[model samples]
Target: MTTLQILWFILIAVLWTAYLALEGFGLGAGMLMPFLTKSDRERGAVVKAIGPHWDGNEVWLLTAGGATFAAFPEWYATMFSGMYLALFLLLVALIVRICAIEWRKKINSDQWRARWDWAQSISAWVVPILLGVAFANLVQGMQIAVVKPSDPMTAVPVDQIDLAHDVHNLVGGFWSLITPFTLLGGIVVAALFLSHGALFLNLKLAGDLGDRAAKLAAPLSLASTGLTAVWALWAQFAYGSGQPLAWVPLAIAAVLLIVSTAATVTGKIRPAFWASFAGIAGAVAFIFTNMAPDVMRSAIDPAYSLTLWDASSSYGTLKLMTIVAVILVPIVLAYTVWSYYVFRAKISVDDVHPAGLLKDKIRLGENFLATN
Candidate 1:
């Protein structure tokens, strides 16, 4: 209700949106590495493109998580408790990805690095899926128990609480994590990332590899975008809120996806990249619009839905955080841009001289390609 609160909400939303858009590009770039880079030289370039910035880019997820915990403790508690398993999986993926990036060069044995390569690829695919699932569960609400923490003697146990039927709190399970809407979200994320990766390949790798990446990105993005369109429409019908804009972003994303794919297919790297960028921007916008006003909506009962009004932290905290963000966000963006600019050339095999973190990865990729 306060002006400060509204401003804080806007700041957090912007931060989250930017994070998804920026990181989404890297995720796409990483996934395309294997496909776009056919040789050791090209793969190195792909890795090098993302090397300096991946870690920094990932800070957005942390910022969003910490902000949510501080600003909306209640929503954080409810959603985390409900989606514990799914969140856990995402954490695992994050760890694998970080470790793979760091340890790829420590070992000389190609096989050893190959394991990390596999880990990198799997985690890359899973991160978007887990994120999509988590968001879907939040919007749809999950099966959760209403618990009061007043009368416990020592510690509250799961066994002691009444296991009641509350549809808004769904148990974060394998099936729930792979629901239709969530799967579509996952596909959208993956395809968009792959498209971004293709653009990155064009920017980072020079010759045949970049061309291969371009070829791969166009078809994959188109297929995934088509799937997303069908699922988005189905979601509107299945979880019909009768809100016209609920599914509008999906349509917009589809159009952007088509443009991006077409551009890639036609060997228009710059246009494809911009189109992919627009597609990603549209996807995030769609998500925000679909879940607007309410950070988390209920599939069962409208009364149980949690909104920005109900889930916010104290006004003082919001105001302070907003002030801090005003200074912090710009600095983050500046450094990010600087780093990318410094490393903006395509990587080549001749550049790999048996040193740095990518030595083992390059060798492994060579071996893997040779074997296949």
Candidate 2:
């Protein structure tokens, strides 16, 4: 592969890593909202902990998708088009989760808040599970068959061209995406995020809430460590035979997972949170390492796999993208860091308020009608 192609591949991987690390905690916090606190005020505090940064974190997802579409159109086409249904559901879940976060406090009614809270919780759980399943399938390889454009001289229709046995269009149902290994991957990520969220709560809450979160984090971290170990080992044995170096990241991830659990048990919340973040990052690193050169592997025939070289855009395109990314990525990162720094304070029941966008809108409407 050209240097530009390699760079773009790494950049895409980094974007995904950032998304999973940042958004994982947000999702975790959302999932824990109803269970972590009985009082509405406490639950609002949980939402407040992540509210400032959750939207910013989701930008990574958009950037990753845009990067893939620009740098590797074929990979984007095959993956997105092939998994359209699953991705649609994921998008829906994200939308619901975002709405829940924004609208939960719009009214003072218990029933209104409770309805949105359920929406937030369900979507939070669903998004991570979907993402995990998708990642596992990517690692395990999908049934992808690239179709070539028809020759114009022969006047052959693109759809009617005879395809080789090993070459066909993307074909599979939702059931094809799920497997024992993928299910395990979903569990591993879900557990990891749960621990990460609990650790975050420990850091951003005080008093009884903080204590409960820390206690919850300990067991969740332990469970995550075990599940991650199983998933990593299985991936190594199943797919890393040719890529022996992939085991290094797997080992590092395992170590970090262990460290996270230990730190949580020792009541070192920050260390535990960072360890969990590093552990997830390491797991993603291992996956990309194992899949290197090949962007998408075909389970039926290895020869039909999509490699970075085959999937990447032209060198000039990548070079231009590189320039744009270099200019914009740092600015985005700086703003994100500044935002976090400014909002780096623990939230509590006292921080909860009934005022929201809906209230402002209602007042504006009343004023307009009165003036009229």
Per-residue lDDT for 1-372 in model 2, tens only? 788998899899999999999999999988887778888778778888898999999999999999999999878977887678989999999999999999888767667777888899999999989898888888888766545544211222334544332223355456778899888888888888899999988898877887888889988888889888888788778866386788888889888889889989998889989999998899888889888878887675666577888788888899999999999999999998999899988777787786544533465435544643
lDDT of 1 by residue, 1-372 (tens): 677655655555566666666777667766666655555445545556667878887887788888888887666776776677778988998899888767766656566555766677788888887777666555555443333444212222445534233212433334654666776666766766766776766666666666676677667767766766775666567654566776677777778878877877777878877777777667666665666566666554455566676777888788788788889989988997897788777776566543344543565434544643
Number of clashes recorded per candidate: 9, 0
The list of candidate 1 runs beyond 4 A from truth reads 2-6, 38-42, 144-146, 150-177, 244-252, 356-372
lDDT of 2 at 92: 100
Model 2 clash tally, residue pairs: 0
Candidate 2's C-alpha runs over 4 A off are 148-168, 356-372
Instruction: Assess every candidate by TM-score.
Output: 0.83, 0.91
Candidate 1, pairs of clashing residues: 28-193, 29-197, 142-168, 142-169, 142-170, 143-169, 143-170, 144-169, 204-346
lDDT, candidate 1, at 79 = 74
